[model samples]
Target: MKTYQVGGSVRDELLGVEPHDKDWVVVGSSPEEMIEAGFRPIGKDFPVFLHPDTKEEYALARTERKSGKGYHGFKFYYDPSVTLEDDLLRRDLTINAIAKDSQGKLIDPFNGQDDLLNKKLRNVSNAFCEDPLRAIRLGRFLSYKHISDFSITPQLKAIVKKILDSGELNYLSSDRVFAEIDKAMQNHFPEKFFNFVVENKLDKPWLKDINSLDGFSASNSDLRWVELSCLNHFTDFDQIPLPSKIKKLISIAKQLANIEIDNILIENIDSLRILRNEEDIMRILSLGLECMDQNLITKIVLLYKDIKFAELEKLDPNERKNEKINLLKDLVSKL
Candidate 1:
């Protein structure tokens, strides 16, 4: 069997960035043989295995043919005869299609290195138009540090526009749509993800509420979510099947966003100290009260830190809360 390092790790190495994760593509290997060699099967829709020792993913060289619609409608074919070139041809971008041999030699099947040098994002083959999610993924790579500066060729943009017009994006599941957005939120310039979608008018069905992210500057995903949803952009927030804790955070952020800063009560501030993350919750409240002076935000974080100073473990729950309420009164008076 011939195993080669492929996909994002290769692309990141070409760009001089150290990759955090690595995936392998095995050519001339079958599932039975892989099992005999101690590789654990993991893929549900494709032939992917995990190395016995390292536990890294190692997928057999496979080719996919479009049969219907959406991400799972493709029919994946894998066998010992599937060439490395066949697997690369089915990839989305040329940069991602390159592979590295076990002997430290690079394989450039579609001239991905040339496009890498030109700082261009181009499709590997015509199969790129087969999966509509690539359009959103393009926006994802556009938000990162290295690929963020790379130019999307007009040819690829036209393909994306074609995919958008084909209505295939509507077939994407809500979870998949949010998955892309969630990953983009971790990028260096995540606004580029939303900006690209807005510019391309690719916000139909799932991302319809994404209009603009003009003044957003936070790199924290929860902060990003609060900022975006508070402005009514991530309107699909309630339907995204996120964790219950995240839902509570969104609910709290919404409360903070619409609350009258002048009429803000001590109870509201006191309630914040009970949440899991006092710092982020207070930060969200501070963002909501943008008209307040910068001194107030700093003081608010500091004051909330001390609201639970006394050992209320011995008192009744109601008295403990009242104690917090009284302390909050003293704290807000200083503000």
Candidate 2:
């Protein structure tokens, strides 16, 4: 069997950036043969094996045919006859479809190397839109730190729009969908992700609630998530899957957002039972101070830090809450 390093690793290396992970495609290989050669089987949908020593994934060269409806309905065909070119055709972008041989020779069956040099992001084939997830993945790549400068070709945009029109977006798992957004949140320009989604009409029911920002440069990812979720008119916190902690922060952030700056000094901030932890609420407000430049938020957070929660523990829960609110109002009145 012949092994060739394929996918983003090859593309990234050509772009003069260090590859984060390497993926290999084995041509002229079978599951039985791979097992005999000491590779462990792991793939549920296709024939994928792990090297006993390196533990990196090595998938058999395969081709996909749309058997039913969406990308999930594809029937995979893997055998000794599938060529290296066949596997490349199944990739998302031309830049990602390049392969490097074991001898370190570049294989450009689809001219992905040229696309890489031009700093262009384009689809490998018309089949790129078949998988709705690529629209999200491409958006993530657009916001990637290294290749953020890459231009999305008009052809690529049309294909991605086809993905939006496919009506197969919901076919993807929520975890998979969130996984892309989470990665984009960590990228250099996360706002570009949302913009791209909106530009290509990729923002369907899943991301329709998010209002695209002109610019958002929040350093913290959770804070960034909070900012985006609150951009929606109704703030669809339950529409997307998020960790409980992030959901809590979004809930608190929304509360702070809805409150008029003049009305922050209330009897008890947790009157709605939403803002549970003072520390969490302050954290969200602190980010609000930086991102939104709400000077009132800074004063509220600073005044909160001065109030000693330990001293309030001596009183009952109701009394302690009232005392804390009284102390906050007293401090705000002094300012």
Best by TM-score: 2
Give the Cα-based TM-score of candidate 1 against the true structure.
Answer: 0.84
Off by over 4 Å in 2: 231-234, 259-261, 265-294, 305-335
Worst 10 residues of 1 by lDDT: 288-297
lDDT of 1 by residue, 40-125 (tens): 99999998899999999999999999998877779999998999999999999999999999899998899999999999999997
lDDT of 1 at 86: 92
Per-residue lDDT tens digits for candidate 2, residues 266-291, read 63343423224667666666654433
Model 2, poorest ten-residue lDDT window? 267-276
Best-matching candidate per lDDT: 1
TM-scores, all models, native as reference? 0.84, 0.86
TM-score of 2: 0.86
Which regions of candidate 1 are displaced past 4 Å?
214-216, 231-236, 265-277, 285-335
